[model samples]
Structures are given as C-alpha cells and as structure tokens.
Target: MKRAGQQGWSTTEYLAILTGLVVLWRSSQLVLEHLAEHHDEFSWALMIPF
Candidate 1:
C-alpha cells in the first residue's frame, strides 16, 4: 500500500538524519579539542561557531 511505502521511506530518512547528526557531533568535538589546544591561533575562528 501507498501508506506502507511512505512509512518505510520515512524510517530510512530518519535513520540517515540520525547518522549524520552523530557524525557532526563527533567531528565538532574533535575540532573543539584541537582549537582549544591552539586557542590563540584560531580565537576569531572559534567565534563563528559560538
């Protein structure tokens, strides 16, 4: 049925978005750590995210 197909599509879309968010969060943590160690060098750049 059309409703079942739509549900399947939505489930896949939800999973894709969830995965993307996890990847972004992990990368952001890494970037923040690196910037923290070199704070003086990227002080202005850090403001963009904040």
Candidate 2:
C-alpha cells in the first residue's frame, strides 16, 4: 500500500495549511458575528453556511 506522506508533503507544510484554515475560519466568523449584531434581520441565515 502507498503511504500517505509519500507525495512529498512534510509535517511543517501540513501545519501551515491547518493554521491558515483556522485563521480564515476565525476571521469569517468575526465578520459574520458583526453583521449579525448590527444587521439583526439576516442573522439567522449567517449560521447556516450557505
């Protein structure tokens, strides 16, 4: 069987990608929260992710 890391991706590369995704998710959540607070009407849809 082929190993998962055999494609040349190292630990550091994986960590960096994970960190970037976390940052992106947090930033988006903050923006959504702000909008939900100030724009009250559409707040419910924000949590739906669509």
Per-model C-alpha RMSD:
5.1, 7.1
Worst 10 residues of 2 by lDDT: 1-10
TM-score for each candidate, following the candidate numbering: 0.65, 0.59
The deviation in Å at residue 43 for candidate 2 is 11
TM-score of candidate 2 on Cα atoms, chains taken together: 0.59
Clashes of each: 0, 0
Per-residue lDDT of 1-50 in model 2, one digit per residue for the tens? 65777645676688899999999999999998888688877766778965
lDDT values for all models: 0.92, 0.83
Error of 1 at 36 (Å): 1.6
| Candidate 1 local lDDT, 1-50, one digit each (tens) | 47988999999999999999999999999998998899898777757964
